[model samples]
Target: MKITFPHMGNAHIAIKALLAGLKLEVIPPPPITKRTMELGIKHSPEFACLPLKISVGSFIEALEQGADTVLMAGGWGPCRFGYYAQVERDILKDLGYSFRMVVLEAPDFKLSELLNQIKDLSQKVTTLEAVQATRFAWFKLNAVDRLEFCLAKMLPRVINKEEVLAIYRQALQEIDQVTTRPQVNQVTNKSTAEMEQLQQHDQPLLRLGLVGEIYTILEPACNYDIAEQLGRMNVEVYRSVYISDWVNDHLLGGLVKPSNRREILTSSRPYLNYFVGGHGRETVGNAVKLARQHYDGIIQIGPLTCMPEIVAQSVLGEVGEKEGIPVMTMYFDEHAGATGIQTRLEAFVDMLQRRKKSNQVWEQGEQLNAHVPGC
Candidate 1:
């Protein structure tokens, strides 16, 4: 079977490796572009979230390239994401596309069924081979995440931001091409060293935390590359979502320790005590935690009409007021424009910088007062 899946940032790399390892012909969808966005908007319902539309377009592009199966992840929550796979399947069927829709739902205590489905997908492969493939794919996922973490740290500090991006892109390509863990490690280390070697300004940098819907948080195309944009503006960003962290919570909950979820809940207890579905609680929690840690500001980005993020955005006002941290929420859809988003981001960054300068001046004035004797 020729299997394909929607693009979600670096997820395509590990997913492609996993399917190829399972002895299936993998047909990765083309990189998301304006055409992809147009296709999704044209076919999807008017009210559907941006992710669903983009995913439909991605699947169509892959299917047109001879892929026979579409692999999609399923969710269970009040969030509309849980229904996306079924919705997309219907849309594709109506368009007269012939393909198998494979939905990998959250295990939800039915792990045996999940394994059985995976086994069925690769009947020719043995259990040991599947285990090895899965292990390798996990390593690849972590490797890229490490690279991203490094890139986030270096992007704001490096003198030549474009050079840092080029190194990061090259490193990702090398990681994708390698098959072994050692090779992945070697490339990650080399690229990280190269980034570190680049000349950097010694000025203090603004730290911003990004919290929002998983797809928009992880997919640059959906969020107008907010992380990169902030980085180029000399802001150090701490993102709330990572694919490995999501897998740890949903797919491998039994096997992996849910430390991340526990931390999120603990921090979110004051503002939101329960899951509002999607990453709503996590967004609130991460924002609070980042505020306590003295992050300069926080930005929440998600698709328009996303109920969970909307809930979190409402709560964030109180969080910002109580914690003394500035908060901004950005919602996007098919009609969202890059220029407008960038202008907003630029304004936010400038405000943070001005606030920092004002704070410094106040501190200096306070020090001067301390030196005077009862003026």
Candidate 2:
């Protein structure tokens, strides 16, 4: 079967590696772009979340490129994500596209079913081969996450930001071409070292935490590359979610230990105690975590009309007030513009800088007064 899947940040890279290793003819969807968004918007429900539209557009693109089957992840929660695969299937069918849809349901509670699905997809491969292929893809996933983490840490500090990004793109390309553990490790290490060599300023900058729906948080096209924009503005950006962490905690049954969900749920208790759907709880939890860690601010991005993120956004205001942390919520759709987002980001950064300086001065004054007299 000629297989294809939706793009989510570096996910396509690992997915390409996995399907190819299974000896399948993999048709990688074209990168999300204006045209893709247009195609999705024209055909999707007016009120559907942004991710659904983009993914539908992506699937259509892949199908046009001769992909006979579409592989998408399924969810089982209050979030609308759980319904994506079936909805996209019907939408594509109505559009008169002839293709098969495969939904890989959340495997945490259905390992055997998930394994069977995998085996069926890898038709001619042995069990051992399938296991090896999965392991290789897992390593690639971890490598991509590590490379991204390094880029986030180095982006704001680099003297020439473009140079760091150039190396990063090249490193991603190199990593994408590899199929073995050692090769993934070699490229990741080389990329990290190259990033480390970029000239950096020693002074600290405003630190911002990003928390939101997973797709919007990770996909640049979806969020207009907000993290890079923040980095360019001399702000340090930290995301609450990563592909590897999500896969490990949810799909792998917490094999890595110290469950991300546990930590998030515990921290979110003061604001939201139960799962409201999507990453709403996690967003609140992460915001609380970042607040306690003394981050300058937090930005929450999600698709317009997304229930979970909306719930999180409502609670975040109270959290921000209580914790004395600034919070900004951004909703994206086809109508969202980069220029507008940049303007807001600039204003937020300016506010944080002013607050930081004010606090510093106030502390200094208090110290001086204490040393001068008992009063």
Candidate 3:
């Protein structure tokens, strides 16, 4: 059977590896572009979120490339992501496309059920083969995330950003092609070393924490490469989510690795005490975490009309005021323009820098006052 899945950042690389290991033909959708966005917007309901529209467009592209089956991740939450598969299936069927849809729900502490879903996907594959494939794919997932972390660190520091980007791209390509742990490690180590060696500016860097929907945070196209843009402006960007972390927490039941969900939940207290679905709680929690860490500012990004993020955004003002951290929220749709995003980002960064300078001046004044003799 041939399989295809929606493109979400670097997720397709690990997924392709997994399906290929199971001896299934994989048809990866073309990289997302303006045409893809247009296709999705044309077909999807106007009220649907950006992820839904983009994913629908991805499926249409894949189906046209001879993919007979589509694989989609499922969840159980107030987030509309749980309903995406059914909605897309109906949309595709209306478009007169013939294909099967497989929705693999998050394990939700049910490993056996998740295994059964895998078994259904590859009936002929033995238990041993399935285990091996999953292991290797997991390695690839971690490798990609680690390399990306390295890229994020180097982008703002390096004297030549493009060179670092080139190294990062080559590393991703290598990781995508390798099928073994050692090979993945070799690429990651080599690329990381290369980035580490690049000369960096001596200027102090402002750091920003990025929090919001997983798709908007991870998919550079959707967010217009916000992290990289900030880096180019001499600001460091740290994200609150990673695909590897999500997979471990949801798909593998945290057997391979544990996410910081416990800590995030604890930090989210007072500001947001309960899960509002998607990454809402995580957003508020991570923002609080970053504030405690002394990050210069926080940016919350998500698709337009996203309920969970909207809920999170509502609470962020209080978070910013209480924590003494400036926060900005940017919502995206097919109509989102790069110029507007860049303009707002520049303004936010400028405000943060000015605030930091003012705080420093006030602290210096307090120190001088403490040294003065009272009359």
Candidate 4:
């Protein structure tokens, strides 16, 4: 059986390498595009997470490429992500597609359970082999995400916009071929060292932490590649969610949202127990951490109907107000506009710069309706 995972961002490299190293056959669907979103919107539930729809479209595309098995992460919570795999699978089956889906569910705390899910998710793969695959998958995911973080931190210094993407592409390609930890570290270190050499300056550019739902924040096709766009505009950005984050969230009870109490209390041993649900609370904590480190601003991105992010939206607003930081909130969907997003981003970045100079910040609890329909 051939396995395929949905595309999220510039993460295909490390993830692909993990599969390759494990000798598991896997494929990634094409990047989200106008046609991909169109198909997703046409077939999926109107209120579904934009990522889920894009993922469905991605799976269908992969199936066309001779992939018969799909792998997806599973969850359980107030968030809709918990039910995404089952729903998407049913949708695919109803569309007359013949394929097997492997969903790794949360609420199973044991490492053994996770390994079991890995086995189950990789249809036709043996349990022992699946355990090995999980380790490889983790290595690939951590490597890719850390590389992204390093690149993001360096983007503000990249004078040429095209060069940044070129370097990014190069790193992605190199990572896809990596096997051992030393190889992964060497690849990342070299890529980041080059980026730093190219992006050196006396003063850093505006640093913004991006927090929100998993898809709209990570998938460029869905959010119009906002992070790349932000990087081009000379804003250093950090993303909130990742494949590993989801894995940890499900495995560790939940992604703590500090806005909630029980989660924080239950998380005594863990330093980040305050993060209650999703990246909303964690986003705030990260922003506070970044702000204390002297970052310029925080950007809170979310889907319109997503309750966790909605909770994040409000709490982050309060956080921004109290901390005297400039925060930009944008809600995205199928109807989101590129031009508008860029324009608001420009304005926000400009505002952040001005606020830094004047020692002033956005009014407490101010709301910007960067909202679009169908989110």
Candidate 5:
């Protein structure tokens, strides 16, 4: 059967490899765009969180392309993500979309169990092959993640920003086409090494804390290239979500449900009972944490109409105020454009630089005045 998967951050390539190993055809949903958001908003529940809406949009787009199966992740948490796949599946089924939605659950205790499901996918699905594929996928993922972390650094400084982006796209293309496990390892190592070597200057990079829905933060398309813009402005971007977070949210959180539940309940004791919504509490927690660290600003991104992120953004203002941090909220709709996002980044970066310079000048002036016996 033809297979598809909804886009998640930068996961398209890794998932494609895993599915390819499983001997499936990959019809990746379109790179997220305005039309993508429109499709999602039109079909998904209006009140659903932003990430879910975008996910629904992605699946609909894939379905429209005649894809018959969707490979997706399952989760467990106060975060609605645990239930997102099931709810979305039923929603699409009700809409009369013909497709199979396969949600991969927490890893089974037995390695044999993991191998069996994996073998069912690969024509040559042996225990060895499964292990190889998983390892390859993991290292490649880490390399990709680190590239993002590094790019998030280079991005804020790139002149003719798109110039460096052109190079990054080329680098990603190089990383994605390797044909073997050894090649995957080599590609990951080489690409990461080169990204590290890219030259940089010493502008005090605006320390921008990234707190958002998991999918959007990880997936470049979902944010419509917001991170690239931030990087071009020489902003040091800090991310709150990671593959590790996904593992914890779904894997460990499942094993320690009561403890996890209690932690959520207690931490959010100030808000309502913990938000079962995606990334809402995480966003707030990340913002508060980053502000405490003295990040220059915080940018919270989520799919449009995402309740968790919206609620998080609602409280982040207070968090920023209490901690003396600047917070900017970026909400994306189908029609979101790079130019508009660029405008905001330019404005935000400019403000941060100006404020920083002003503070420095005031302090210097105070020092000079004291020395001159003036005031």
Candidate 6:
């Protein structure tokens, strides 16, 4: 079967590696762009979340390019994501696209069932081959995450941003060209070293934490590349979630759950004690954690009308007031503009810098007063 899947950040890279290794013909949808957003907006319900629309648009494009089968990750939560696959299937059918849809549910809940699904997808490959392919894909997934984490750390400090970005783009291309885990490791290591060599200031201009729905945070196009924009403004950005961490927690049941996740849930308890939907709990929790860590500001981005983030946004005002950190929430749809996002970011960064300077001055004055003799 000629299969395709939606794009989420660098997920398609690992997915393509896995499916191709299984000896399946893979048809990757084109990179997300305005055209993809337009297609999704035209076909999706006005109130549907942005991710659903973008994914539907991706499938339509893939089908037109001869992909007959689609593989989608299923969910089980209060989040609308749980209903996406079936809804998209119906929508595609109505649009007269002929394709088969395979929805892979949470592997942590039913490991054997998830294995059977993988087995079905890899009918042509032996068990050993499938295992090797899966391992390679997992390696690529972690490697990409590490590379991205490095970028986030280095972006705000680099002397010439374009130099770092060029190397990053090259590293991605090199990783995509390799077929083995060792090659992936070599490329990632080389990229990391190259980034380390870029001239950078001893300290970042500012530090910000990004908390939001997974798709919007990971998909640069969906958020108008907010992280990069912040980086250009010399703000070091830390994301609350990563695809590898999500896979480890939700799919692999790896030995150690991410500490940040546990901390986030705990910190969010005062405001939101239960799962509202989406990443709302995580959003609230991460904001609390970042505030305690003394991050200058926090930004939450999500699709417009997303229930979970909406819930998180409501609680964030109180969190910001209690924690004494600035929090900004941004919602995106097909209509979001980069210029507007940049302007908002610029204003927010200015406010943060002034606040940081004032705090530094106040601390200095307190220290001086403590050392002075009584008069």
Cα error, residue 204 of model 5, in Å, equals 4.1
Q: Please give the distance, in angstroms, between residue 321's alpha carbon in candidate 2 and its true position after superposition.
A: 0.9
lDDT of 2 by residue, 1-375 (tens): 889999999988988988887888999999898889999999899999989999999999999999999999888889989899999999999999999998876566645555667778867998877777777888898889998999999999988999999999999999999877888899999989999998988767889999999999989989999999999888899999998877766566566435668888899987899989888999999999999999999999999999999999999999999999999999998888778988999999999999999999999999998899554
Clashes (backbone N, CA, C under 3 Å), per candidate, total 0, 0, 0, 6, 13, 0
Q: Clashes in model 4: which pairs?
A: 220-225, 256-275, 256-276, 257-275, 257-276, 257-277
Worst 10 residues of 5 by lDDT: 252-261
- lDDT value, residue 171 of candidate 1: 96
Q: TM per model?
A: 0.96, 0.97, 0.97, 0.82, 0.80, 0.96
Runs of candidate 2 exceeding 4 Å displacement: 110-112, 256-258, 373-375
Supply the TM-score for candidate 4: 0.82
**Tens digit per residue, CA lDDT, model 4, 1-375:** 677888877656655664654566877677667677777888899987778778888888888788888878776656788788899999989998899887766645556766665555545667777666666666767777777777777777767667766787788777777667788778888887877777455564777878667667777776777888888777778675665665455543443322332332342212233445555555566656655566688887877677777776766666676677777788887777778988999899888878775554343213333343345
Query: How well is each residue in 1-375 modelled by candidate 5, as lDDT tens digits?
Result: 778887777677777777776666778788888788787888877766667777888889888898888777776655667788899999899999888888777665644554566666656566677767765665566656766666666666644566556666766676677767677667656655665566666657678788878777877767876776667567778887765455445543334222333343344435434564666776776676677677888888887776677778778777767778788898875557778888887898888888888988999999998889545
Candidate 5 global lDDT = 0.71
**Models sorted by lDDT, best on top:** 3, 1, 2, 6, 5, 4
Global lDDT of model 6: 0.88
Which portions of model 5 show Cα errors greater than 4 Å?
Answer: 33-38, 47-50, 64-66, 77-80, 94-97, 107-124, 192-204, 243-276, 335-344, 366-375
Which regions of candidate 6 fall more than 4 Å away from where they truly are?
A: 108-110, 202-204, 253-260
Winner on TM-score (1 vs 2): 2
lDDT against the true structure, per candidate, is: 0.90, 0.89, 0.91, 0.70, 0.71, 0.88
197-311, model 3: which lDDT tens digit per residue? 9999998889999999999999987888899999999999999999898887767776678678889989999999988999999999999999999999999999999999999
Q: lDDT of candidate 2? A: 0.89
Q: What is the C-alpha lDDT profile of model 6 across 288-333, one tens digit per residue?
A: 9999999999999999999999999999999999999999999998
Candidate 2 C-alpha RMSD relative to the actual structure: 1.4
Give residue 361's error in model 2 in angstroms. 0.5
